[model samples]
Target: MSDPALVTIPARRGKAARVKQGQIVKVINTHGDQVVDTWAFNADDLNEFMSMEHTRPHIMKIMPAVGDAMLTNKRRPILTFIEDTSGGVHDTIISACDRYRYKFLGVEGYHDNCTDNLQAAMGELGLAAPETPCPLNLFMNIPVHADGSLSFEPPVSTAGSYVALRAEMDLVIAFSACPQDILPINGVGHLPTEAHFSVD
Candidate 1:
C-alpha cells in the first residue's frame, strides 16, 4: 500500500486536490499525449460544480463508460467513472481552452489555457473556482460527426494510460495539463505534455 503520491499536472500547469467521500482519483496519462482538464467541486458547495451538461443527461453517453456517475450541477452524484485504461476516448463536448480559445486558435499572445489552468488550480487550494465548469475531458479525442459535427481528434491515450474517479461527495478535484498547442487536441505533435494524479 505505498505508491499513491504522483501529483504533477504541470506542463501548461494546474493541479488541485482535496477529495474525500470514497476517494480515488488516479488520472495519469503521464505521457500519453496529455489532455487532462478535469474538474469537480462541492467540497461543501462551491456552487456545486462538476457538470458536463449535467453529465450528458446523467450518463446517457458521450463517452463516460466504466460505471458512469459524474452528475452535479445540482443533479447530484459527483464523480464515479471507476476506472479506464484510457482509450475510452473521452470528451463530453469541448469547451475549456480559454483566453478566448487562444484568440480563436490563431494565438498572437499568451496561450497556456484550460481556462487559465482552472483558475490557477483553484488558486492553489486557497479556493475560488465558482464558475468554469464543463470539464471531464480527460484524454480528449473529440470526434463526433455524421452531421452533428465535432473533430479535434488526436489522443487515444498511450504512454501510461489511466483514468479513475470516485469521490461522489466531498470534492474539489481540478486538473488541467492541457495547454492545447492549437488543436489536434493535444497530440499530432501539437505538444502539451505533463499529467498525473493519484489520491487513493
Candidate 2:
C-alpha cells in the first residue's frame, strides 16, 4: 500500500492525500447522496495538474467509464477510472464552489466552501492553485438537458457506494465534501457529513 485509507473528510471541509503511482484511492459517501469534488496534481510537478478541459474532449463522453483515464493539462494520464458503483454518474463541467457563489446566491454571512476546502488542502501540501479548474464531481447529478443546458438532480449513490481510481503517476489528491446546501447537491437538508478515503 502506498498510503492507507486516511481519515473521514469532515462535513463542509476537504483534505489532500498522497497516492503513489499504481496505488488505488477510493472515495466513499457514507451518508449517501453526498458529492465529493476531487482534484489531482502530479506529485513531482504541481503545474502538470489534472485538466477537465483536456480530459473531456479526449474521452468524448460526458460521463466517463471504467478504464477511462482522466488526463492532465498536458494530456497525460492522471488516474484511471477502474471501478464505479453508482452507475458512472459524475460531472466534469462544473467547477468547485467558492465564496463568491454563496454571495451571488444571496447567502448571508460567510460560508465554508469547496474553493477554500481545496485551498486548505493544497496549502498543506506546500502547493498553490495556479488556476481555477473544474473537478471530477463524484456522484453528482447534473444532467444535460435536451437543449444542451444542465439540470441538477439528487445523486443515486446509496451509503457505501464508491468510485475507485488508480493513480497513473505519483499524485497529490485533494477533495472537498461539497457545501452547497442551496443547490440541493446533497439532497433534502443540504447538510454535509463525513466521507472516507482509502489508498491501497
Best by lDDT: 2
* C-alpha lDDT of residue 193 in model 1: 79
Per residue, candidate 1 scores C-alpha lDDT tens digits across 75-138 of 9998888879987898878888788878886889787787888888889989889788878888
Candidate 2, 67-132: lDDT as tens digits: 899999999999999998876789998888898999999999999999999988888878886765
When superposed on Cα atoms, how far off is each prediction in RMSD?
15.9, 2.4
Reference-based TM-score of each model: 0.32, 0.94
Cα-based lDDT for every prediction: 0.85, 0.87
What is the Cα-based lDDT of residue 191 in candidate 2? Answer: 82
